[model samples]
Target: MEMIVSFILAIVSYMLIDNVVLSRFYGICSFIGVGNKVKSAFSMGLAVTFVIMMATLVCYPLYFYVLVPAGIPFLDTLVYILVIASLVQIVGLFIKKTSPSLYKTLGIYLPLITTNCAVLGVVQTNSDSQLDFLTSLANGLGTSIGFLVVIVLFACMRERLNGYNIPKAMKGVPIALIVAALMAMAFMGFGGMVG
Candidate 1:
């Protein structure tokens, strides 16, 4: 029972209170760049989620079993980056072959996942926190879900805002930035619940 409760709390905390994009501010580039359209945002979110999960699965073991024993912990960041980059390449090829339309829609943003801090952040967090495999998996999933949730919601809002007659000065990226800030503030409310 305690384990189950802990797992649930971990999910809630990562998914809501400590969201990667909204709370930690990781992956903001794609969050804002591709977020103007809901379909594209959703695709980017899934691609990010897939990379995070797969990278975590690979990275966690490599860090503990290989790096730690070798006394080369300093290489973790470099190694993690390589792992994520390779995974993204594989996923990109799969997406390209299976759904060329999504590949086109994602475009550069899909490749941008290679450098997305959020992916690195997840791997680094797992190593730093020293979480067991199950907890680390939970964290990865929750973080990706959080990313998906926020980007999709933001895209919907942007779609509506496009129809509104706003001030000339507050158009485009300016308004998007303001909305992102407001959303960040709103997500702050979840902090207390998790804490």
Candidate 2:
């Protein structure tokens, strides 16, 4: 029961705050580059979250049952990366064939997800935390939600800033970075809850 509660809280916390791109500054490449519109940004966020949760689902059992017990924990990084990469590829291909529209929308970014640090971060956290399968699932879902929230928020901000006059030095990536940093500080408020 306690575990279940923790899992739920973790998920909610992750969704409402502590997003990867916003909170941890991971996946900034996609967060800043791809997040120009609410729709596309939301899609990218959902895609990233989907990948992270699915990858965690596959990686955890492999780590707990196979890698760790075999005295090859050092191999965990390699194995997790390989598993995630393969799973992302398989999923991307499946989506491309099954849904042409989705394929068109997400196709370009799908490959980029394979190497995103945010995805790897989720797996690493799960392994290190020793969370049970269900908790890990909850954590992954929560983390993904967090990612989505941040991406969408950033996209909205970018959209709002489209017409703003900005100084040459403070334009583009620099302003985006500042916004992201401020967002991270905002998310820190939630960190106290989990702590």
Candidate 3:
């Protein structure tokens, strides 16, 4: 029971309070750019989630067993970047071969995941905290789910916003920014729940 409760809390904290996109503001590039359509936003979210999980899986073990033991923890950032970059390449190739349309739809955003701070942030946090493997996996999964939830909701809102009348100055990216700010504020409500 205790472990189950802890798991539930972890999910809630990550999904609502520590949301990578909304709360931490990581991965905003693709968050804003690919969020105009629901399909694309979901695809981006899933891709990001997969990359985060894979990176965490590889980075955590490498950091603990290799870097720490070798007394070269300083190389963590570079190593993590390389690992994430390589994983993104594999994901990209898979997408290209399996679903060319999604590949085109994702376009630059797919590659951008390599540089996305959110992905690196997850791996770095896991390594720095020295979380056990299962906990690290949970954190990565929770963070990705949070990313997916926000992007999907944001995309839906953007789709609806497209049909509304608005001040000329607030059209396009301006309104989108405003909407994102509002969403961020709404997410702040969950802060107290975690604490």
Candidate 2, position 169, lDDT? 98
Worst 10 residues of 1 by lDDT: 102-111
- Per-residue error (Å), model 1, residue 42: 0.8
TM-score per candidate: 0.91, 0.92, 0.90
| Candidate 2: segments with Cα more than 4 A from true spot | none
Residue lDDT tens for model 2, 1-195: 987788888787666656666666678788888856898888788789889978987898899999888988778888888988998899898998899999887888898898788899889888887878887887789878877878888888888888999888999889988888887788777766765
lDDT of 3 by residue, 74-138 (tens): 99999999999989998888988998788887656778898788899888888888787877887
Candidate 1 residue-wise lDDT, 1-195, digit = tens: 998888888888999999888878889888888857898888788888888999989999999999999999989999999889988888888888998887787656767999788899999999987889889988999999999999999999899898889899998888998999889899988887965
**C-alpha RMSD for every candidate:** 1.8, 1.7, 1.9
Per model, state how many residue pairs clash: 0, 0, 0
Best by lDDT: 1
Sorted on TM-score, best first, the list reads 2, 1, 3
Q: How displaced is residue 190 in candidate 1, in Å?
A: 1.6
